[model samples]
Target: MPKRTATMLGCAVLLGMLMGESRAQTDDPSGSPGAGRATVWIEPSVSVGATLSSNGNASSSNGRSELMLDVTPALRAVLNTARVKGFVDYSLRAEYFLDGNSGNRLSNRLNASATVEAWDQRAFVDVSGSISDQSVSAFGPQNLTGLADVNRSETSSFRVSPYIRGTLGGLVDYQVRYALQTLNTDTSIRSDSTSQVLSARLGSRPVGQQLGWFFDASAQENDYVIGRDTRSDIARAGVIVSVSPQLNVTLSAGVETNDTITLQRESYNITGLGFDWRPSLQTSLSVSVEKRYFGTGYNASLEHRTGRTIWRYSASRSASDSPTQAGSVRLGTNYEIVDALFAQSIPDPILRAQAVLQFLANFNIPADAQNFQDFLSSSATLNQTQRLSVALNGIRGVITFNVSRGTTSRLDSLTTLGDDFDSNTEIDQQSWGVSYGHRLTPLTSFNAAYIDQKSSGSSGISSKRQSVSLGLSTRLAPRTSGSVQLQFGRFNNTAGSYNDAAISGRITHRF
Candidate 1:
């Protein structure tokens, strides 16, 4: 059979199932005493679209067209009072592209949970399971090229977990959870492999007047059927103390350990302290400092809001023993300009802007003291960069518009990475769009939008793109609705020019 015929058959099946479910629910009573209980309801939808593209260059032009179909089905359920009350959900999705250049794909997912209540709703037990599958075809266009190549690949995963939580004597709360995850990978050039991961977490909180404390610890073990093994463990604790009605302080610290089956193991220790203060109803500030064996950093921010205007400022810095240091600062503000004009009938038009600057130093480090000293003495200068962005938005009734622009400048000494990675380069980009919607009747509406974008990079590369879309939605019956959409786009670049068009539609029924 033809691809189009198969797609139509799939759509018919999906629609039939949805209609059957809706009809079944009509005679079912709502969950109540002495009610004939129905345990589940499933909803599904399918859509088909066609895409056509054409390209023209100074020498030649090429064109192609493709028809694509997508099917998505969802499951949802509610259970009655059986010492547990929860829902199970599952989805199956598949897509087919008519053009032989692209291949078909299918994906499946499942999630379910169960819960039990104890001690008058103060304690509970929860169990959950999740599974996923993904597969790709071999006949599609190749993505990567190497000496040893794979024709096709598939991956599947599953996870199971159980946990318990409750408050103790109305003063303290505690919780614990454990999870096991397994993965299977299949490839054409290599033998199939499997892996497993086991993880556990335990935590508790102690309540007090004006002061609270909490602690948590976790561990994970990873084992591969045909690879090296790894393990990780972490422990953390923190405290929150209220100094006044408007002031609070927080302190936290943690340690992490990593072990490898055949390599040197490493450990890291980290600590941090922070606080927040509110001097008035419209002003607030926060600051924090942190240190670790690998690096050190600090951050702070201040914000104020009054009437229809708001302002903010922030800064941060970090240093590493590996001979690298970096810092950044930013200032931003937003104002409601139109709200002050029409307080009753119209909403506000808001404008926002921000400016940021940063500096970085790069140097090499080694275990040998002599090598590290020599590396620093070579004289490396710090690089500086700056960026700025501004945007404005407005809304009135069924129409909305937004516009934004951004620019970046960097120093020339930072051009060692690539032509596109030069520090002395300047990049400018801008985008603007508008959307409108109108309701012709209580159950019907029309919507449209037009968007345009342009961007340029340091390598003198520039491009422009624009798109226009229109859609209509309507209710065909009391329990059924449908929508149709049309879109067109054009793109122009230094290398070539391209144009594309597409049309799609969907219909759904609900109980």
Candidate 2:
């Protein structure tokens, strides 16, 4: 049996044993007086789900399916009469891909904690330890290949960490932690690696009402075999001050350094500040500004809520000396119109429906300075999108519908030095979809969805796509559930037509 399956079975057996012991104690006519003092409790659960997708485009006409199983079991011991307590939690997970080309992955994690109270429960010493392992397969395009080609790689990693926390008086607390991680890879070749990290933080709350401050920092180092070695280090110092119950401010600065075996080392410094205000019970706002060696930006937003209505809006702008700059603004709102109309209805099927529209404008690209300059000088463009969504609920199921339209303007210039450059471009796109989900029983459900999309570009490029999917899920046992899904999609691209279909299933149990 697989490791995950074995672990689930072991947990089931343990739960059975515990139940039996509890029953025996309850049935004893002359139970031992001390028996009542023994405290034992366990909680376990598991879940498994899977999805499959297939595309029609020849270049992407492949099908893929995934199955995952997860289990978690925890136990806790609390001695209210004593000053000590402890708890332990463990989790196991595994995933499998139906596509013959895909590899399976697995993970296991464990956490243990203990705490001791002192000073009339105002202060305490807490300790915690954890261990985890993760393994996964990799396959995809590589820079070394020149063109996209098949290549496979697998990596397994493990981590161990421990930490301690304590409080001084009633106003201050601190914590420190350290962790070590190791990684191993097996493929046509083999490699090994290790890393270490250390972190610490301290915080305090003055005797006054609603004021606090904190500072944190960390550093890490990595060593590798069969590859260039690298090291990264960072230190941060910051503070938070609450001016009043409704206003606050925060500021921080940090330095970062990076070095590689065969590459030149680099270092930089960063600083930032932010402020928040809740002037009233229903309104909140925040803003921040920052600048780096080559770039600077600022952002701000405000939100308000009353009864069943909520409104929100935000805008931001950024620029860099690399001769690149861009800015955008957005506004939207959501309201529970139906709930207000049917306040007396026991279960309104039309829970809510919302319509939203947004516009985006882009100018200049720092990374592609040449292309951005040519396009901007030849064509000034504007883009906008509008969306609408509706949701309905019933005793057994829920349904949702969504639609969106998008458009972009013309481009006028092709060359950096072209005099005729009057930037202008025109493009349009539309998409719509509907989805439904039903709960057949306490442990079973069904879901389905359909979507259609079309797009046209100013360069005479046009395409359309359609997709449909359905799935069913049910519980096989108290702790185990199984699911199956089917999906199909077709696309008519500017180059050609494509279609694909796929079906997949999975089973999972929890402890």
Candidate 3:
């Protein structure tokens, strides 16, 4: 299918299903807002700024200095109804260089997701989409600023999932789900692809029993616009036991067949063990281990919250084939981190989210700056990743810290041109960041932050980038604000090294 036609078809299907479901439900008789009726929020804002950069092109050596003007108009919309929940944040940024040394540019950024209960307790649908700037190559030049660069490209992806659930005469509970996803990029270095997954599960429906069992099956296929298609199928059966009020254990055996490693399909036995532990309301731990066709795979995570702090840690190793899944790994933003930290104190999810957003905005913190991102690839890979994060809130200040490391190894021998795995067998990436914000006055705030990232390929290519910044923000008036920032950065790699310095001021008005 053509790209544009596929996009339109996906949108039409999502809209038709959502509209059909909306007509089937009636308004709540209680007359209370958000109970059954739709509650919507729309926020629009614009910002203008001028920046002076010592290195505008982000070149490795002998870069030219330039002065640029930037204007960004952004909108955030949130919808809440008895049957649907969704939100979208979008921005359009325009840049013009005053020195005539570089051409003008325009870019778009968006993030959105929605879930609809189409058939009340039996059927549902999920839709999500995103457009963002990302690096095309892991070995290319790296930068701290969100400026236009030759190595960066606009990437977008969409997913639609619809599923049904019910029970069979008080004997077993079952669910069947189908998901379709598409990925595209502005640059030719990365391949656009579509993925389809169909999965089903049947489990014993127990009222108060301590033991249960389940059967699972799934088939997945991925087709690339540039390379050969890949497919996989798996079937499994598992038994679950409640060890105690706070712990549960599961054991499973299965078989999987796939053509990811070679042209011919191969079969392998699968064995797995897993446990979930939630000793208290403030903590949770989950661990799973499995022996698969590629190798031994495992996942573990721990989360704990205190009155004024939160800590999270996770580690995992698995085989990944779809670029959409690989690129979706995220460490979240400052707002999300702080929101999770306040869950113990605030209890209410909606209230906590609003409070966190307000607090970050007041302190001039960048709420959308993620700690790490992965480059896109078409070939299959064995990926191992680890992440740790913590947030602390005090009476007059807030601090957050995050760190992550990951390694990707080629799983297939086929040489896909322009793929990261084409020349190197393995790639390693690591990043860490820390930020502090303090209330200087009732209406003014101060913030400081530092971030560092490093990447290395087994083929003897490596790059490192570091940045430090300070800023101050104050409320100019109602629905208006102004801020100023100063930043310095350093970049080094096998090619060369460069240093950058920048200062900028901006004003924003909300409506």
Using TM-score as the measure, the top candidate is: 3
lDDT of 3: 0.81
After aligning candidate 3 to the native by TM-score, how far in Å is the CA of 125 from where it should be? Answer: 0.9
- Model 1, residue 452: what's the lDDT? 69
Q: Give the TM-score of candidate 3.
A: 0.92
lDDT (10s digit) by residue, model 1, range 458-479: 6667666677878777777765
Q: Candidate 2's residue-wise lDDT over 1-511, tens digit each?
A: 1322333343334333434444443323557565443333334545454544342112344423323232333332222224444433445656554544334555454443444453465454343333332111111111110111122233333343446677878677787766555444444233355556677888885456455677777676655443444555666666777788788887877775655312555776868788899999668898876553223445677666554344444544332111011111001111122232223332321121111100000000001001000111111223344555554555666555556665544221222322111211455667777666677776677877777777666556666767777878776775566677676776576566656665656664544
Per-prediction TM-score, please? 0.49, 0.44, 0.92
**Candidate closest to the true structure, highest lDDT:** 3
How does residue 334 of candidate 2 score in lDDT? 15
User: Residue 332 of candidate 1: its Cα lDDT?
Assistant: 11
RMSD of 1: 15.8
Candidate 3 residue lDDT tens string, 223-327: 888777889999999999988878889999999999988888899999999999999998999999999998899999999988888999999999987766532
Off by over 4 Å in 1: 1-62, 70-72, 76-101, 104-158, 167-172, 181-208, 222-230, 243-248, 259-263, 274-438, 448-468, 489-498
